[model samples]
Target: MNALSIRSIHGRQIFDSRGMPTVEAEIVLHNGVRASASVPSGASTGRFEACELRDNLAEYHGKGVSSAVNHINTPIQEALVGESCDDQWTLDNKLMVLDGTQNKSKIGANAILAVSLACAKAAAKAYGLELFRYLGGLQANTLPIPMMNILNGGAHAGNNLEIQEFMIVPVGAHSFTEAMKMGTEIYASLRNCLKKKGLSTGIGDEGGYAPDLNGDEEALSLLMEAIQLAGYQPNYDVKIALDAAANEWYKNGHYIFPKLQKKITQSELKGYWEELCQKYPIYSIEDPFAEEDFPGFSELTASLGGSVQIVGDDLFVTNPDRLRQGISSLSGNAVLIKPNQIGTLTETLSTIRLAKEHGYGVILSHRSGETEDTTIADLSVAVNAGQIKTGAPARSERVCKYNRLLKIESLISGSEYPKK
Candidate 1:
């Protein structure tokens, strides 16, 4: 048996859904198998996440990724040309050490992630195994329940709502297919309900309708109505989640709700979440507090962690060290997993392993600014993350992930959490 070495690595600047440029890398093994992956951009990115390098020149409104593309072809290329393709950890570590930055800014986390994901694809292709199998071992077969973003507000769209994402979780569905079907149905019903009420059905970035709402409660109430109208029971057949993206609205030790024309202190925010959990079928709340307020996170978790999933995205940035700290402090019960947050699959996997070890749930996520990349679909299944936060079933970029999951389900065995 001969070891397959990396033959060549190259990258190019491509456009994402927002028409902004991003980096895409292609890796070819000596055996002629080639794989490519593209990095997605985030509109409401965390400060602690790895730096997404951009060419801040006069071109493309400084959104150009030409510099990152260059990093792939030169520095990244030189580092991995003769490396073995199967040892993903070794190849990824080489990139990390080469950059020598905590945030992977030297080569751009975008460039590093593109190469990292592309390398994983190349290995999976060489082994003739599914990408999820390559990453999750034999036990990686379950499709994640979709946390479909149906009402986009805050940073995801040009709306007056403060909540970042209002999601629908088909908790009662037995299989991934059923859950997805329920989501699509509820989505259509919501659009119809909006149209009947003479409300704007225009969508936000994540394909959720972005009508000007009075406040977050309005969003929740409408979703509940839509669930019953769609012939599903709320809190039983389906549930709700919120990605407050609190970092977007947090300022000066207060959560500024511009729509409500008020500010919420940490205690107020915690009380508000508790009230919502009790009133509605809310199952999860993400970034419910400011990013740096670890104690606030801990307080929210301590109060509502048993009843709901208090997930930390901006709080931990998917960094293992930060997650470890959160565990010690009892900040959150689940961690949102975004590969670009840490810049490599190895690190992303490490975070998932650590979170699982600490009894924390994992939710694989996608950014608001996305492309037609289905890598995250495979990733969710590979890690059996159990939940995925992709946008609604509207845009081609968003639907590509759902379509990929449907295909994966066609190949794998039956579901573990079959519809009850």
Candidate 2:
């Protein structure tokens, strides 16, 4: 028997950062090496995302993951035990075939992803290689630029603001550590700015300040003030990014801004975004239109793709097919890669590779309802994705990814931070 062969698999239900139950799986190799991984949940999920199964019982408010845990501990365990853990594609394919569902609805994406990640962790341990090195080979030495979210709105918070997230990107940093310094300083300065204005400094699901400001532009103004107070030059040392999550408020052929009390056509919204980008140091805008509006995304990309990074989160959901369509249509210039969005490490890497092959920028990301899993941090480096969006530096669940990236930077002999 191969020493790297899987010996057994076990799964259990664990609570995520949102105190919601999620699936965690452990894998033991024949050589006695063991590893485990946990899956995250997403609050602003896409319609095309793979299914995350849960029990409908009263426990955990019908969010209990006992059914997913049972699937991992039983059917997946039976199908994967005694199998070779060397080939990730083969193993991931097996999981997909076992489920025999396009969206992983039968066995649950959460459960399949837990086992899939655990196998990778166990294989890396058995081979005495770091997870990034194991998955990406020796060429995996590029640290991603951190896109830190500092302000929040939309579904992520109870605020009336229409935007979902307002992020700061440290494009001028020479290294990942310097990027973290710039991001954290601005975050602190923003907190102080809000406190002085008597606005709530309370954080949202992704640890960004969810202050009830006067309007969406006010949020941008506060961010600019914070950036200047932090002693960083806007558009030079740092830049702004937004996750509009426009699909949340998109009504029949129009975008609704409740705080602004305006219902405007898609073209009007596009013009508004153009005005903001011209007025601010904005470098990236994600999901500027609804998920279904590929034509709108394409038009925006054509207009702003030369300067601004147009990212697709809900539009792609890290799905390769959707990305291919976007690439063909020139929908957006970038993709937001969330592992849970696709439900497996192999599929996630495939999407990253596909996006890069098409000249699209890749931003590996964390879900709003995340866990302590640092797989995405390694994944970003493993693929040299060049950018990451892992929330603010406040919550431990979000900070854990940054901490792991810092550790990875220390371990690499000649790590490089991506150039702007």
Candidate 3:
């Protein structure tokens, strides 16, 4: 038997950061090497994202993953137990073929993704290489600049603000460690500012503060003040990024802000974004339009693509086909790569490659519902993704990634931090 051949496969249900059940898969190689991976869930998922199967039973409020866990422990394990885990593409394709579904709804993307990532982790161990080095090869030495989300709204928080995430980008940091220091200071400063205003300093799902601000403008203003309070120069030392998640508020062919009692057309929304970009040190705007509004994305990209990174999260969902469409239509200047969004590491890497081939910036991101899995942290470095949108410096689920990256920085020699 090949030493790299899978000897046993196991699956179990695990609770994520959101207290929701998710699939976790463990792969044991014949050589006695073993690794396990867990899948994360998203609260505000895109319509086009791969299916995350769940039991509709009353258990766990219909967020149970028993069905997905069963698929992994049974049929998926049966097919992959004797297979070699040396080649990620082959193993991942076997999973895709076994399910034989377009969107992985049959076996659940959660199950397939867990097993797929576990296989990769086991293979990396068998080769005696770190996960990042194993996946990215020797040239993968560029550490990504972290886009730490410090404030939350929309579906992610109970705040009145319309934006989903307000992130701080440490643009002037010389290294990944410095970036984390900047992020930590800014995060603390933001908490102080919120408390000073007598606002709720409660944290959201992704570890960002959920304050009831007046609107998006106030949210931006608070972020700016926080940066300044942290002794960072806005736009020079640090910049702002927004995940509008516009799909959350897009209604009846118009965008609505209930807190502001405002409703505006796509064209008007574009003008508003334009004005905000001009007034603020905004470096990136993600999901600026609804997922289905490819035209709106293209128009905004054309208007601000040169100076600002108009990223597509829901518009692409890490699907290469959607990214190809965006590329052809000139929809956005960047793509947010989420492994679960595509159900496999190969597909995720392919999407990153595709984005780079077309000159689009790549950002490895975390789901709103996360686990202590630091796979994305290594992945961000492996691919030199240049940017990562893991949440703030709070919460173990979010901080695990940052901690892993910090360790990697200490271990790897000659690792360069990518220019922000």
Candidate 4:
């Protein structure tokens, strides 16, 4: 292994035809190996209105998007200037150390995560191995799970009901075309089912729900029908999950926990959940209520214990203090791990370990405003997370992560490893 000299680090603003900002980071290796990662800056026009937080940390800190891009480029390039490519761990550790002291509060967690992902990609290419195999051991096969996203109701309720909910069907076959065909079939079935109920077929960023299908039992029932029609068999490899993203709506005196408790009667909520578990075999639910509702979380956990996972994202916010409280109180059974929430890979992994040890499932996730950085893909395999929740495999940015996972699976196809 030759010494790895950081050639140059650069950033550029790429946009979809709609003029949305997708920031790309490029790191050139001394051996002429150039690797890049991109993420949506969440600063695009008309995007913020659809989300809960008007400004992610980039806006909160008053730093421009370029600041984060530069944070990743500068220190990482300097740290790896004369390091060996094979010393990936050592290099990553060194960068983590610098980030801890110098850039602690500058650009927030996104910078460190972006840098780590770029380095991981470069290292994977150097070894001619897929990123996951390089991070985690091989598995007999990759399993596909159903994915659902919180599109409306509560905080993300914009007038336009793009398809906010999603079901991810992982097609690990060698042929991308075949995988896409399967996805299309599943989507068509779901759409037909929704249409039969006179509901909208679009979800996530595609289509909105009907005005009458507000966040109630009726809406959920329609969703259940659509999922079943999509040929999804609950619990037998077809697991169901929901991303509430409810915290976004609680900013201005909305008080989600109490409202959820009041709006959704316990019996009704429990009945719907029971039906979901029995019908679709849902395995996980994220942010069922507002972030601060610890008591409500405990009640839900106690009620639905061992039946499914209750995941916390906005509640924990990557803060160790909150995680400790959640664990002690039995608030939820899982934590959604997003490195950018805490700003460093070291801390993120530490949280994952802590959660696992405390008897909680770890789920690696991507933000709605995401980049092409595939770090979460590797981290999911590395940490053996219970699952990974990126958006549906529709857009290129979202599919890019899934595509990388497929490559990882290919590299370790025949290896005997325990399921993660």
lDDT of 4 by residue, 252-311 (tens): 544323333434443454455556557654566676656777776787788776877888
Order of all candidates by lDDT, from best down to worst?
Answer: 3, 2, 1, 4
Best-to-worst TM-score order: 3, 2, 1, 4
- Lowest summed lDDT across 10 adjacent residues in model 3 is found at 252-261
Better of 1 and 3 by lDDT: 3
Tens-digit per-residue lDDT, 1-420, candidate 2: 888999999999998988999989999999999999999998878999999998989989999999999999889989998898878898999999999999999999999999999999998999899999999999999999999988989888999778999999999999999999999999999999999999999999999999898888999999999999999999999999999998876777678875666888899989988999999999999999989999999999999999999999999999999999999999999999988888888999899999989999999899888899899999899999999999999999999999999999999998988888
Off by over 4 Å in 2: 258-261
Q: Give residue 104's error in model 1 in angstroms.
A: 0.8
Query: Which parts of model 4 have CA positions greater than 4 angstroms off?
Result: 15-19, 40-64, 72-76, 84-103, 138-146, 150-184, 196-199, 206-214, 231-239, 249-281, 318-321, 415-420
Error at 366, model 2, angstroms: 0.2
**Residue 247 error for model 1, in Å?**
1.1
Across 1-420, the per-residue lDDT of candidate 3 in tens digits comes to 999999999999999998889989999999999999999999889999999999999989998999999999899999998899988998999999999999999999999999999999999999999999999999889899999999998899977888899999999999999999999999999999999999999999999999887778999999999999999999999999999999887777778875566888899999999999999999999999999999999999999999999999999999999999999999999999999988998999999999999999999999999999999999999998889999989999999999999999997898899766
Q: Could you tally the backbone clashes for each prediction? A: 2, 0, 0, 18
